[model samples]
Target: MSNVTTYKVTGMSCGHCEGAVSSELSEIEGVSAVQAAADTGLVTVTFTEEPDDEAVRAAVDEAGYELVGRA
Candidate 1:
């Protein structure tokens, strides 16, 4: 089954930032799609499996952004 998750991210100031976040999230094992918006500070991810929040956080952190929260 697939699930969609929205994560609140901080410190995204431009399109490049959004791209970076999106790229990182896309690399996750079960992630199917990633849409990141710098203006909204949100990253919406679709996954084929339930992904651990920590995994999401780590990917964002490695991309030089902060995962502030999720919905």
Candidate 2:
């Protein structure tokens, strides 16, 4: 089944930041779509399965942002 998950991401200040976060998250195996908003610090992800929290966190970190847990 498909699921939508939202995570709190910090340090995004522009559209480029949003793209950076989204791009990194998209690399995850089951992720289908990523919507990141710089203004709200929310990154919404659509996937086929519940992704591991640590994996998500690492991707966020790799994108130079902070994942403040699920939203």
Predictions in order: lDDT: 0.92, 0.96
Candidate 1 residues lying further than 4 Å off, grouped into runs, are none
Consecutive 10-residue window with the lowest summed lDDT within model 1: 49-58
Backbone clashes counted, model 2: 0
For model 2, how does the per-residue alpha-carbon lDDT over 1-71 read when each residue is reduced to its tens digit?
A: 78999999999999999999999999999999999999999999999977899999999999999999999
TM-score of 2: 0.97
lDDT for 41 (candidate 1)? 95
lDDT of 2 at 43: 95
User: What local lDDT does model 1 show for residue 56?
Assistant: 95
- Candidate 1 residue 48 C-alpha distance from true site, Å: 0.6
TM-score of 1: 0.94
Pairs of residues clashing in candidate 1? none
Candidate 1 steric clashes? 0
Model 2 regions more than 4 Å off: none
Candidate 1 lDDT (Cα, 0 to 1): 0.92
